[model samples]
Target: MGAVTMGCGDSCPLVRAKVREEWNIPDPKDLPDDDFRKIRDLIEQKVTSLLAQPTG
Candidate 1:
Protein backbone atom coordinates (compact mmCIF):
# COMPACT_ATOMS: atom_id res chain seq x y z
CA MET A 1 0.00 0.00 0.00
CA GLY A 2 1.99 2.96 -1.27
CA ALA A 3 0.37 6.34 -0.72
CA VAL A 4 1.66 9.69 -1.88
CA THR A 5 1.05 12.49 0.56
CA MET A 6 2.02 16.14 0.47
CA GLY A 7 3.66 16.06 3.90
CA CYS A 8 3.72 13.97 7.05
CA GLY A 9 2.54 16.76 9.32
CA ASP A 10 -0.09 16.08 11.96
CA SER A 11 -2.81 17.83 9.97
CA CYS A 12 -2.07 16.11 6.66
CA PRO A 13 -5.25 14.34 5.58
CA LEU A 14 -3.31 11.98 3.30
CA VAL A 15 -1.46 10.45 6.21
CA ARG A 16 -2.09 6.74 6.65
CA ALA A 17 -2.54 4.73 9.83
CA LYS A 18 -0.26 1.88 8.75
CA VAL A 19 2.95 2.99 7.05
CA ARG A 20 5.65 0.33 6.95
CA GLU A 21 8.51 2.42 5.61
CA GLU A 22 9.35 6.07 5.09
CA TRP A 23 11.95 6.87 2.43
CA ASN A 24 13.34 10.33 1.82
CA ILE A 25 14.07 9.73 -1.84
CA PRO A 26 14.58 12.91 -3.80
CA ASP A 27 12.65 13.74 -6.94
CA PRO A 28 14.52 12.43 -9.97
CA LYS A 29 12.63 14.33 -12.63
CA ASP A 30 15.41 16.86 -13.33
CA LEU A 31 18.30 14.62 -12.37
CA PRO A 32 20.94 13.38 -14.79
CA ASP A 33 20.79 9.87 -16.21
CA ASP A 34 23.24 8.44 -13.68
CA ASP A 35 21.45 10.02 -10.75
CA PHE A 36 18.11 8.81 -11.99
CA ARG A 37 19.49 5.32 -12.37
CA LYS A 38 20.74 5.39 -8.79
CA ILE A 39 17.37 6.44 -7.50
CA ARG A 40 15.66 3.72 -9.54
CA ASP A 41 18.06 1.09 -8.26
CA LEU A 42 17.53 2.18 -4.69
CA ILE A 43 13.77 1.96 -5.11
CA GLU A 44 14.09 -1.51 -6.60
CA GLN A 45 16.20 -2.65 -3.67
CA LYS A 46 13.72 -1.35 -1.15
CA VAL A 47 10.81 -2.94 -2.94
CA THR A 48 12.61 -6.25 -3.15
CA SER A 49 13.37 -6.19 0.57
CA LEU A 50 9.79 -5.34 1.41
CA LEU A 51 8.41 -8.14 -0.74
CA ALA A 52 10.72 -10.63 0.91
CA GLN A 53 9.19 -10.01 4.33
CA PRO A 54 6.49 -12.33 5.68
CA THR A 55 3.10 -10.70 5.76
CA GLY A 56 0.82 -10.89 8.76
Candidate 2:
Protein backbone atom coordinates (compact mmCIF):
# COMPACT_ATOMS: atom_id res chain seq x y z
CA MET A 1 0.00 0.00 0.00
CA GLY A 2 0.97 3.60 -0.59
CA ALA A 3 0.74 6.55 1.76
CA VAL A 4 0.51 10.31 1.39
CA THR A 5 0.98 12.49 4.43
CA MET A 6 0.26 16.20 4.71
CA GLY A 7 1.55 18.36 7.52
CA CYS A 8 2.40 15.27 9.43
CA GLY A 9 4.12 16.13 12.66
CA ASP A 10 7.63 15.06 13.67
CA SER A 11 6.27 11.92 15.31
CA CYS A 12 4.33 10.73 12.27
CA PRO A 13 4.11 6.94 12.39
CA LEU A 14 4.00 6.47 8.61
CA VAL A 15 7.30 8.19 7.97
CA ARG A 16 9.21 4.90 7.96
CA ALA A 17 7.17 3.40 5.16
CA LYS A 18 9.03 2.61 1.91
CA VAL A 19 6.41 4.08 -0.41
CA ARG A 20 5.21 7.35 1.03
CA GLU A 21 5.14 11.02 0.18
CA GLU A 22 5.50 13.55 2.97
CA TRP A 23 4.45 17.09 2.23
CA ASN A 24 5.22 18.83 5.47
CA ILE A 25 2.90 21.72 4.74
CA PRO A 26 2.04 23.85 7.70
CA ASP A 27 -1.31 23.58 9.40
CA PRO A 28 -3.82 25.88 7.73
CA LYS A 29 -6.26 25.99 10.59
CA ASP A 30 -7.46 29.44 11.58
CA LEU A 31 -5.64 31.09 8.72
CA PRO A 32 -7.15 33.82 6.57
CA ASP A 33 -9.15 32.71 3.56
CA ASP A 34 -6.51 33.78 1.06
CA ASP A 35 -3.74 31.98 2.87
CA PHE A 36 -5.77 28.83 3.19
CA ARG A 37 -6.58 28.99 -0.49
CA LYS A 38 -2.89 29.08 -1.32
CA ILE A 39 -2.19 26.04 0.79
CA ARG A 40 -5.10 24.24 -0.81
CA ASP A 41 -3.78 25.02 -4.25
CA LEU A 42 -0.36 23.70 -3.30
CA ILE A 43 -1.84 20.45 -2.08
CA GLU A 44 -3.88 20.10 -5.25
CA GLN A 45 -0.78 20.62 -7.35
CA LYS A 46 1.07 17.93 -5.46
CA VAL A 47 -1.83 15.55 -5.90
CA THR A 48 -1.94 16.25 -9.61
CA SER A 49 1.76 15.59 -9.93
CA LEU A 50 1.47 12.35 -8.02
CA LEU A 51 -1.41 11.21 -10.19
CA ALA A 52 0.65 11.83 -13.31
CA GLN A 53 3.32 9.42 -12.20
CA PRO A 54 3.40 5.98 -13.80
CA THR A 55 2.54 3.25 -11.38
CA GLY A 56 4.23 -0.13 -11.25
Candidate 3:
Protein backbone atom coordinates (compact mmCIF):
# COMPACT_ATOMS: atom_id res chain seq x y z
CA MET A 1 0.00 0.00 0.00
CA GLY A 2 1.11 3.55 -0.58
CA ALA A 3 2.32 5.66 2.31
CA VAL A 4 -0.80 7.78 2.11
CA THR A 5 -2.98 4.78 2.88
CA MET A 6 -0.66 2.99 5.26
CA GLY A 7 -0.16 3.66 8.92
CA CYS A 8 3.10 5.16 10.08
CA GLY A 9 3.85 2.61 12.80
CA ASP A 10 2.61 0.98 15.97
CA SER A 11 3.05 4.12 18.07
CA CYS A 12 1.12 6.45 15.79
CA PRO A 13 -1.87 4.15 15.38
CA LEU A 14 -3.26 5.03 18.78
CA VAL A 15 -3.81 8.64 17.82
CA ARG A 16 -5.93 10.19 15.10
CA ALA A 17 -5.28 13.41 13.28
CA LYS A 18 -7.76 15.81 11.68
CA VAL A 19 -5.56 16.18 8.64
CA ARG A 20 -2.94 13.96 7.09
CA GLU A 21 -0.99 14.99 4.01
CA GLU A 22 1.95 13.68 2.10
CA TRP A 23 4.10 16.07 0.11
CA ASN A 24 6.07 13.33 -1.76
CA ILE A 25 9.01 15.67 -1.85
CA PRO A 26 12.45 14.31 -2.64
CA ASP A 27 15.21 14.05 -0.11
CA PRO A 28 17.71 16.83 -0.72
CA LYS A 29 20.42 15.36 1.50
CA ASP A 30 23.01 14.59 -1.21
CA LEU A 31 21.93 17.14 -3.79
CA PRO A 32 23.52 20.47 -4.72
CA ASP A 33 22.89 23.45 -2.45
CA ASP A 34 20.81 25.17 -5.12
CA ASP A 35 18.54 22.19 -5.52
CA PHE A 36 18.22 21.88 -1.78
CA ARG A 37 17.18 25.51 -1.55
CA LYS A 38 14.52 25.00 -4.20
CA ILE A 39 12.93 22.16 -2.29
CA ARG A 40 13.21 24.11 0.92
CA ASP A 41 11.48 27.07 -0.64
CA LEU A 42 8.69 24.82 -1.89
CA ILE A 43 8.12 23.45 1.61
CA GLU A 44 8.11 26.96 3.02
CA GLN A 45 5.48 28.07 0.52
CA LYS A 46 3.29 25.06 1.21
CA VAL A 47 3.48 25.59 4.94
CA THR A 48 2.76 29.29 4.53
CA SER A 49 -0.35 28.54 2.53
CA LEU A 50 -1.55 25.92 4.98
CA LEU A 51 -1.14 28.33 7.86
CA ALA A 52 -3.20 30.87 5.98
CA GLN A 53 -6.22 28.56 6.05
CA PRO A 54 -9.07 29.10 8.49
CA THR A 55 -9.27 26.51 11.23
CA GLY A 56 -12.67 26.06 12.77
Q: Pick the candidate with the highest lDDT.
A: 2
Residue pairs with backbone atoms closer than 3 Å in model 2 (clashes)? none
**lDDT head-to-head 1 vs 3, winner:** 1
Tens-place lDDT per residue, model 2, 1-56, is 56787765454574465577779887888889999999999989999998999888
lDDT of 3 by residue, 1-56 (tens): 11122323233454576665567677778889999999889888877887797876
**Order of candidate numbers by lDDT, starting with the best:** 2, 1, 3
The per-model lDDT (C-alpha) reads 0.67, 0.80, 0.65
lDDT of 3 at 31: 85
Listed in order, each prediction's TM-score against the native is 0.68, 0.77, 0.69
For residues 16-51, could you state the per-residue lDDT of candidate 1 as single tens digits? Answer: 545535566777789999999998898888778877
| TM-score ranking, high to low | 2, 3, 1
In candidate 3, which residue ranges exceed 4 Å CA deviation? 1-15
The lowest-lDDT stretch of 10 consecutive residues in candidate 3 is: 1-10
Evaluated at residue 7, the lDDT of candidate 2 is 60
